[model samples]
Target: MLTQLSLPKLQIPFLCHGQFMVRVLVVSQAVAVVLAFAPGVYGDVWARLGFISVFVHWISIITTLCLCAARHKINQLKPISIISVVLCIFLTLTLIVSAVAFSLFSTLFNSINHEMSDFLAKNLMVAFIVALVAVQFLIVHAEKSEQLNAQTHAELNALQARIQPHFLFNTLNTVAELTHIDADAAEKSLLALSALFRAALDVGKLVPLQTELELAKQYLSLEQWRLGRRMNVNWQIPDALPAIQIPALTIQPLLENAIRYGIENSAEVGKLNIFSIESRNALTIVITNPYYQSIKSSGGNGIALDNIRQRLMLQYGSSASLTFGNSEGLYRVKLVIPKS
Candidate 1:
């Protein structure tokens, strides 16, 4: 009962703005058609449409301005709600004023000096109705947009929290063993592990290639210490490619997951390769690890990979892609980052 009562209400400002603008455009178009048929009907229908476009453009501009101003850091909902009501009132007044002016200009021209107050009043009423409908549409749109944004933010936070458990749980177990066997090696391992966590925590949705490389190296160092003679690592990062940016932790987590699953699960020795190349205005990172389906029955947990792919889509739209495949018993993951 309390959860239902206390649920935060969400509103989407973009959708509201969109619906309002679209209605305004439709109304303006109708008005232009009428005006073109009236006295002194300028060029062609296309010219009248272009002229009406300007007013529609202004409506969008003003609505955006209103939204930008709507944002506030107020804690209490009442004050913000009051402000939103006030903004709606202001928009209504603006519409009324615009309607009055248009009606007066369209009907009471000096060339005719005709008494058309009744016609002008009717047009004003129509305009007010149009504006009110637009505002209602705007409110509904805003609510949806706000809900979507909240969901996206929550998902991102969940993904970040999920990563810590998978890597840290395994690392801590390795550290526990290292501490008892070799004190000096364990100390170095702890430091490298700290760097790894720091890197994960510091990263964002997108990061520079140089930063990723540094973090990748730190991760490899920590894992090497943990695995000792059991793990072999190779990295091929060209100096020219260092400046290029990639999705944050895009390459490292996959590498870590590969090592953790590939070598830790296998009794036989395992090797990992990290390679990057810039070709055809695209950056590709390939991570390869030995795979034995008999020993490791399942595929990846998929959360981290899915997170990376989603982040790529959110940040780079359709320009970037990630692919996974197996060839001759070697598991490979590839990331393609487009320059264009």
Candidate 2:
């Protein structure tokens, strides 16, 4: 849970939801057509349509600017009240622009004042009713998207809270086992353990790849006090590692699983190999080890893998992955993270 939920939450600002500019353009174009024909007692239908198009786009731009300016205060209002306020503003703009539109229409076509007045009044009312529906559609759609993201975050936080205690208990066991045989190493392990507690339990955000790698190294060092040379690690990394960010404890659990299932079960001194591949847009980490198929725990990778997958989903959605499988003569686990 810490691995996934610690990643950033999806955010949509109140007035800056997706495709807002495009929605404004499309609604303005649509309303222009309908308003042009609403005044049936008009000459040259094409001329009237052209005239309305100008103010339709004009009104849309002004209304959008006003809403964006007041977005901070408006977001605090109740949903029903928000709708009422939006319509009131739309109606107010319509009333304000009506006289200007009437004068222009009369001048352009030499229409009588009475006819132009009727046309402007009827069209502005039509614009209000149409614009109200369009505005509400955009607001409701954005609200639903934000709500879904919020629920996902809540679930991840709850999962992180529950799993952290289990992880702490397991770490304490490793320290307890080291006390009798090697007091000096146990003391060092306690020091390393303190860092792990801060990195894991009090996670503020994803750490750099180098930072995560060192933590993994510390974990393996602590384990070696008990396992000795049996826990062999071959780290194949570039001289200058890429600046990649990953969730805390992202690679540590995988190493623990390797020791328990691959290293511990092997009759010969077990070897583990870890390396990285940096591409233009992604970082891929591969961990390979020798294992006995017969000794594999049926539920070996369940919780840890689930946790990693969850974290990836939270951070990168479906783009990032944790894939593990045994093939040929080696068991391989590959993790892919997007650079973005």
TM agreement with the true structure for every prediction: 0.53, 0.54
Clashes per prediction?
Answer: 9, 1
- Candidate 2, residues 113-190, lDDT tens digits: the string is 476558667766686667668655656655664565466446446655655565557667778987887788778989
Q: Which 10 consecutive residues of model 1 have the lowest summed lDDT?
A: 7-16
> What would the per-residue lDDT of candidate 1 be over residues 161-265, giving only the tens digit for each residue?
866677777678777888889888778778877877666665554578787887788777777877778888887877666356565677777887688667776
Candidate 2 lDDT for residue 56? 80
Residue 7 shift from truth in candidate 1, angstroms? 23
Regions of model 1 farther than 4 Å from truth: 1-163, 176-184, 294-300
- Relative to the unseen true structure, what is the Cα RMSD of model 1? 9.2
Best by lDDT: 2
Each model's RMSD to truth, in Å? Answer: 9.2, 9.5
Q: Which whole-number lDDT from 0 to 100 does residue 69 have in model 2?
A: 71
Give the local distance difference test score of model 2. Answer: 0.70
